[model samples]
Target: MIWLLDLDNTLVGRDDAFALWAADAVARAGGSGDDLAAIVAADGGGFARKTDVARVIADRLGWEADLPAVVERFRAGILAHVRAYPGVPALLDGLRAEGDRVVVVTNGTSAQQRGKIARCALAPHVDAVVVSEEEGAAKPDPRLLEVALGRVGADGADRRDVWMVGDALHADVAAGRAAGVRTGWVSHGRDAGDGPAPDVVGRTVHDVVAAVRALAAPAGPAPARP
Candidate 1:
C-alpha cells in the first residue's frame, strides 16, 4: 500500500506547537490571556491564511513587527516547538518493513514543512515528501496528489492501494477522493461533521495504521502467466 500523510496536526502536534507560540508571543507583546485567545482563534487551527492570522495577532497585541516579520517569527516558533507523535517512527518503520510505501503530502511552504519533518526525525522514515509551494498546487486539487504519486514512482498503481491520511476534511479527504484513492481521517477527537467522509476514522495516526492494516489485502502467491 501507498500511504500519503499530512504534515501539520497529523504526524506532528502543530496545533499544540501553535498554542505554545501564541501564548509566548502574546505575553512578550504585553498582551493578556484574552489577547492570546483571540490570536489563537484567528489561526483557525492553521486553516486561516497565515498572513491574516499574523495581522490579527499584530493588531490584538499592538506589536510593532511588520506582517512578514510576524509571520516569519510565528513559523520559527512553531518549528521550534513541533514534535512528532510518540511511536511515529516505529509505526512508519513497520509499514515500510511490510513493503508499504509511505509518503508525506502536505499543503505548506517547502522550507517550513521540510523543516518540521527534519526536526521531528521523520525524513528517514517516509519514502517521499511533497509540499504545496514546491508543486505549485495545494490540496482539494487532485494534481497535488498526482504529484506525490509520481514522486514516489507509484503514479500508475491501483487507486485501491493508495491512501491519503490527514485531519483536514476538504483538503485531505476530498483530494484523495478526487485522486481516486481511499482516505483515512485522523479525527483528533472531533466529529467529522458534514464534510467529506473517510474510509477510516481514528483519533490518531496509530489507529488509522491499524485500520489500514486490517483493511489491506494479505499477500498471496503470484498468479501464473498463461
Candidate 2:
C-alpha cells in the first residue's frame, strides 16, 4: 500500500508543541496565564493561518516585536518542542518493513516541514516527503498528492492500494477523495462535522495503524490457487 501521511498534528504533536511555545512566549512577555490560554485558543489547532495566530498572540501579549520577528520566534519554539507521537516512528518503520510505501505529505513551507521531519527523526522511515511550498500545491489540491505518489514511484499504482491519513478533514481527506484514493481520518477526538467523511476514522494515528495493516495484509494463502 502507498501511505500518505500528514506531518503536523498527525504523525507529530504540532498543536501541543505550539501550546508549549505559547505558554513560554506569553510568560516571557510578562503576560498572564489567561493570556497564554487565549493565544493557544486562537491557534485553532493549527488550522488558522500562522500569521494570523502570531498577530493574535502579539496583540494579547502586547509584544512590540514585528510580525516577522514574532513568526520567527514561533518557528524556533516549535522546532524546540515538536516531536513524533509515541510509536509513530515504529509505525512508519513497520509499514515500510512490510513493503508498504510511506510518504509524508504536508502543507507548509519547505524549511518548516522538513525541519520537523528531521527533528522528529522521521526522515529515515519515510519513502518520500512532499511539502506544499516546494510543490507549489497544497492539500485539497490533487496535485500535491499526485506529486507525493510520483515521488515514491506509485503514480501508476491502484488508488485502492493507496491511503491518505491525517487529522484535517478538509485537507487530507478531501485531497484523498480528489485524488481518488481511500482516506483514513485521525479525528483527534473531534466530530467529523460537515467535512468529507472518511472511509475509516481513528482518534489518533496509532488507533488507525492496526486497521491499515489489516487491510494491507496479504489475503490468506491466495486460496491455494483453487
Candidate 3:
C-alpha cells in the first residue's frame, strides 16, 4: 500500500500560524490590505497553501523584496508554531510496519513545506516529500500526486492500497481522488457544509490511522479499483 499525506492542518496544526501571519501581513498590505475572509475563501476552507497566501498577500501589499523571501518568513513562523496532531507518527509508523509506502504530497513553496517538515521531524517517516515548488504543480491537480504514485509504483490495479489523508476537502480529498488515491478527510471540528467530499471522515490523525489500518488489514474489504 502507498499512502499520500497532506501536511498543514491535517497533520500539523497551522491555524495559529496562519492567524499570526495573516494578521501582520494584512495590516501591512494597506488598501483592503488583507481580508482574512478573502484569503480563507480562496483557500477553499482548508489551510492556506503558504506560497499562495504569501504571494497574494504580497501582491496586495505591494512588497518589493523577493517573493520567496517574503514567503519564507511566513513559513518560518509556521514552523515555529507547528504542533503535530496527536498519533501522526504512530499512524505513519504503523503503515511502514505493514510494508506500506508513504509519501507526502503538499502544494507550497519548497522552503515552506520542507522547513515545516524538517522542524517537525516528519522526514524520518516519509518515504518521499513532493512539494509543488519542485513538482511544478499543486494539489487537486493530480500532477504532484501522480509523481508520488509513480515514484512509489502504485498501480491502478492496487488502487485499494493507496490512500490520501488530509483535512482539506478541495485540495486533499478532491485532488487525491482525482489522482486515483482513496481519500480520508480529517475533520478538525470545522464543519464542511455541503460539498463534494472525502471517502471517510475522522476527527484526528488517530482516527485516520484507524481507518487506514482497517483498510490495509489482510481480510478487509478493498476499495473499488480506480
Alpha-carbon RMSD, each predicted model: 4.8, 3.0, 6.5
Task: State candidate 2's TM-score.
Answer: 0.93
Name the regions of candidate 1 deviating beyond 4 angstroms: 217-226
TM-score ranking, best first: 1, 2, 3
Which ranking of candidates, highest lDDT first?
Answer: 1, 2, 3
Residues 109-182, candidate 3, lDDT per residue (tens digit)? 78777888887788898788889889788888988888888777765537766888888887788888787768
lDDT of 2 by residue, 1-226 (tens): 8899999999999998999998888878899888888888878887788788889888988876487787888888998999999999998999899899999999999888999999999999999999999989999998999999999888899999899999999999999999999999999899998999998899999887777767767787545554
Candidate 2, residue 166: CA error in Å?
0.2
For candidate 2, which ten residues in a row score worst on lDDT? 217-226
TM-score, each model?
Answer: 0.94, 0.93, 0.74
State the lDDT of candidate 1 residue by residue for 157-225, as single tens digits. 999999999999989999999999999999999999999999999999999889888877588899999
Deviating ranges (above 4 Å) for candidate 2: 216-226
Candidate 1 displacement at residue 47 in angstroms: 1.4
User: How many residue pairs clash in model 1?
Assistant: 0
